[model samples]
Target: MNQNKLQSLMLCLLFYSNVSVYPVTPETIHIIISEDKTMLSEWEIPEELTLDTLESKIGTHDRTNETEDSIKYIWDHLGIVAKFSKNSKFLNKLTVFYATTLKNEEPKQNFKGKMNFFSSDPNQKVEATYKGWICRFKLGNRSLYGICKGENRNLEQIDILSK
Candidate 1:
């Protein structure tokens, strides 16, 4: 092969080898919530997804809701609060606050980050800025929530959900 062709071939092989050595991890979990603010799909956050890692992945501000037992980071843009337990050192809970009520009693087709948990819905520490529909579920708890997109509900992944 020509010198240029050989170099190109070597580069391709190197790229492919590296990719196989280190596979990319899935970052986002696609989910859909019902209009009533219940999770219609199942979502198990990976163990590696801690508060620190989350903040790094999705930038967060200084605003926080903290106590002796737990710490929460609220991302206004993402409309989600990731809660971590003090002793466990992992993301123990997730609460997603909606921006607006379901249109016509149905989940909105798109989440534009326009809505938030109603003032009354949030914990006292965050009530000042948080405000719409709120859905809170614990990770690895007996009660589980499913993932849905505000589109349809077949409940196909039933095994992942809790009774």
Candidate 2:
């Protein structure tokens, strides 16, 4: 091919590749587990905001009326799942699994993260923040939280909530 024609074809191919590689945004849900491993809670946010906005909202109290009993019930159910083979040792190794779905109909992508529970008293409060689609979880104590971030099917970061 002539130089000009070859360059034109390369540019067109590059443009198509770039556009086809657009990242997919999915609804993100943050799961929080109690220190005692007796409770599990979750909150979901739409996938339109930026990560900064989600971070700013962290620790903002938005009560969900989730009682200890409900959390316990869910924990029991989760324990029976074969994938959670270490459920018996949950207290020492608190875990939070992040999940996402496209349009509420597609199969979910599960991303696991570690969490440290400080207290499990029913009076203790829980909070979360959403930056874009990234979500963070915080328990009653200021020191405990988990960060969940990813694009559609992958989890890039899952760090403990510090400082």
In terms of lDDT, the best-performing candidate is 1
What lDDT does each candidate get?
0.41, 0.34
lDDT of 2 by residue, 24-119 (tens): 112222344453332222333322323233323232211212233321111111111111112231212222234433222211334432333445
lDDT of 1 by residue, 10-108 (tens): 999999776543222223323443222322123333544666655544454335777888776655444455666778767766654343243222223
How far residue 90's Cα lies from its native spot in candidate 1, in Å, is: 0.7
Candidate 1 residue 107 C-alpha distance from true site, Å: 19
Give the distance in Å from residue 116's predicted Cα in candidate 2 to where it truly belongs: 11
Off by over 4 Å in 1: 1-45, 99-163
Report RMSD (Å) for each prediction in the order shown. 13.9, 17.4
